[model samples]
Target: MKKLILLLLTAILALGCTACAARPYTPAGEPTGNAALDEQVLALLQELCDPKADLVTNLGAVYDFLCTGITYRATLADTSGGFTDELTDSLALELLQKRKGNCDAQAALTAVLLRRMGCEAQIVQGTFLRADDPEPVDHAWVYAVVNGTDCWFDPLYGGHFAENPRDYFMADDSRMALTHQWDAAAD
Candidate 1:
């Protein structure tokens, strides 16, 4: 309990020190609120990854699991105000138990699961240009680095973005910049 809190606090402090609102470190896979829920998420993540698989293979499998498993349902019914900010507060367990959440929840859960599987993952928060709107709206997604390559994953958007889900899977930075305006995550 203490270690989880400390890790969370450290993550917060690290983000605080950054010039912009970077991804706050929320160590997942640790039992913070509900142990049962934690185990369930862990088990599901484990089920997704095959030990015999390579790193990219494991990441691809996990990314596919999250995109297919969760739906883009906001925790709050009122989305007129753009619920991304509020929904970001829910921890990974809550997102899993509920089985639906905004981009923030999906990305956070993805990052945690990837980290548990030994992939370097972090949540990236910023604005996303929704086609319906002229301006970018607050959004979050996962950024995982493997073999010196940065791969972007947005399980929320991954749901309906393309007939070929891999279109959004491990997207390169140049492609993501087209619609995503990342808020500087670090100093």
Candidate 2:
């Protein structure tokens, strides 16, 4: 009985030590401000300058520009406090100014910029499953009509339909089951 008790205590101590030794997962990569990117976007928009510019083109340009300029940082905690579904335009602008926010912040900022540019854009609430994730995680992205087709954009992913081409977003109607649609009309 003494030997059995010793063995059990030893096992428990070993397990606890192992758990304590384990390190929390940290995502790699540093945040790149990409100043050149801002210049490029400004130039693009300037070229498309018109009293009434095309909505699709303007929105697409802004989305692509933002995605290229910003780097994904997973350090942001889930700050969706009291936000039932989406953030308001003012909140989105505040996040943009801060330059450090979660996926929802990126989506909100993109939507607001696109809207200001005279493009109809909206925030898409859904689940994004990483290749390793067996189940999807709650996520948010932006979608806007470009050239008569709905184009989905994710700044967190940081790609312009190329380089970081997303298999999920590429689908014609691919959307997560938990997707909640928020729009100006609903407000």
Candidate 3:
């Protein structure tokens, strides 16, 4: 009887540790100082993400919103400038407002949302080769450190009209190298 009790206690301890490790996500990073922008992001999170789900599931929800909710367009704003802070901020806001953007805008918006969700994420400007295209084209995607593992999220290519968009979510370097080409040392 005492041995059975000890085993039960050990199992309870393990479960408790796991639950503690999966603490809820809190908003991180310096606020944009624009209340509207911050509010918009939070609203989107409320609509799209399940607060009780696992981290990867929540990330997938955001990716799904980007892939299906947002439309892809090479807007003048995307070509007019580089990824300056103002440009990135405007692009992210535009993506939420207009739901239209190119790869740059998609990546910028993804990074913004992920950062707001307290995930360490960044935009990666690189090249991508489609199976039908003759040459690789300039592209932008997201690189995130998720749960201490380096993961890649490409909404532009993986989400837009993809048969399996989830494949792009939380992908590692090896899996992303199938089409994405970027300087690993840069980010």
lDDT of 2 by residue, 27-49 (tens): 12121233443333334445533
Residue 61, candidate 2: alpha-carbon lDDT: 52
Give the TM-score of each candidate.
0.68, 0.50, 0.80
RMSD of each: 15.8, 20.3, 8.6
Question: In model 2, what is the error at residue 77, expressed in angstroms?
Answer: 8.5
> Number of the top candidate by TM-score?
3
Clash pairs, model 3 backbone:
none
Best by lDDT, which number?
Answer: 3
What is the C-alpha local distance difference test score of candidate 2? Answer: 0.52
Which should have the higher TM-score, number 1 or number 2?
Answer: 1
Stretches > 4 Å off in candidate 3: 1-30, 78-82
State the lDDT of candidate 1 residue by residue for 136-173, as single tens digits: 78777778876668788886676666556776778988
The 10 consecutive residues of candidate 3 with the worst lDDT sum are 22-31
| 41-127: candidate 3 lDDT, tens digit per residue | 877887877667877788888898888888778866754345776777788888888899899889888888888877888888889
